[model samples]
Target: MAKIDIRRPHSLSVADARSIVDRVAERMREKFGTDSQWSGDTLTFQRSGVKGAIAVVPGEVHVTAELGMLLSPLKGTIEDEIGRKLDEHFA
Candidate 1:
């Protein structure tokens, strides 16, 4: 198994930050068949081989995920993709 954890700081308003996350989540849902839900300030997501939460707080977005055995080898690539997305959307 592999774990990914990322934290990015942003200056956008809470609503705006969440909207960005939602947009990202929508794309993930379409491409990966991920199912997600929001609980307070966190968006939780899961698919066959991955599960994670994106927590949007006052000035930070923290993403954490665990990958199953089949997907473990792609951890670095996945982390880079998340970083790129965070940079694209939150930077």
Candidate 2:
């Protein structure tokens, strides 16, 4: 498996950050067949070839994921998309 980790600073309140995360989860479900759930301020998600968590805090968001072998080659693309969305929502 390939590992992906990303951390970005943001100015959003925890509530707003969570709203952004909810949108992300919906997008992931539509685009990637992922399922997600929130545990406190963290969102945990998984799909056939991916598993991850996004943690929301007062001034930052952290994301971590593992890509299964068949999907590992697309790690950079996946990470870049996440980065783009992060910037779109939080930057």
Candidate 3:
């Protein structure tokens, strides 16, 4: 399996950051067919070829995931897309 780990720093309040992450989750569900749940300040999501968590802290959001073999080859593309979304949402 391949892994993706990205940490992005933001200036928004915790609640606002989490709300944006939830928005990202909804987009993920629509585009990738994944489901997500929140546990404390972290949101975890899983689908057949991907499993990941997005954690929100005081000044950062951390994203981590493992891609299954079938999806591993596309890691760069996937990571880029995540980065793009992060930029779009949090920039």
Candidate 4:
């Protein structure tokens, strides 16, 4: 599996961070129609044979996504999309 991870620090409070994470996870679920679960500081989603996790820390957020197929061509697009969303939601 190919893994992609993104991490960044934000100025929002923990509650706000959690909210942002939830919102992002919801968006991903809606768009991809994936099987997902959120518990405490981590949200994980699996769809189209790909699995992803979004973890929120005290002042930082980390996203780890793994592709289960052999489509290496799509990895960059996936990483860019996740990074863009994180920037938009967290900034």
Candidate 1 vs. true structure, TM-score: 0.98
Write candidate 4's Cα lDDT for 1-91 as tens digits. Answer: 7889889888888788988887777876788788888778788888886888888888898888889776456899888887888888887
Q: After superposition, how far is residue 23 of candidate 2 from its true place, in Å?
A: 1.1
Candidate 4 backbone collisions, by pair: none
For residues 1-91, write the lDDT of model 3, one tens digit per residue. Answer: 9999998888999999999999989988998899999999999999999999999999988999999999999999999999988887778
lDDT of 2: 0.94
Evaluation by TM-score, superior candidate among 2 and 3: 3
TM-score of 2: 0.96
User: Tens digits of per-residue lDDT for model 1 on 39-58?
Assistant: 99899999999999999998
What is the number of backbone collisions in each predicted candidate, taken in the order shown? 0, 0, 0, 0
Pitting candidate 3 against candidate 4, the one with the higher TM-score is 3
Score every model by TM-score. 0.98, 0.96, 0.96, 0.88
Span of ten consecutive residues with least summed lDDT in model 4: 65-74
Winner on TM-score between 2 and 4 is: 2
Which of 2 and 4 is the better model by lDDT? 2
lDDT comparing candidate 1 with the true structure: 0.96
Model 2, runs deviating above 4 Å: none
Give the whole-model CA lDDT for all candidates, comma-separated.
0.96, 0.94, 0.94, 0.82
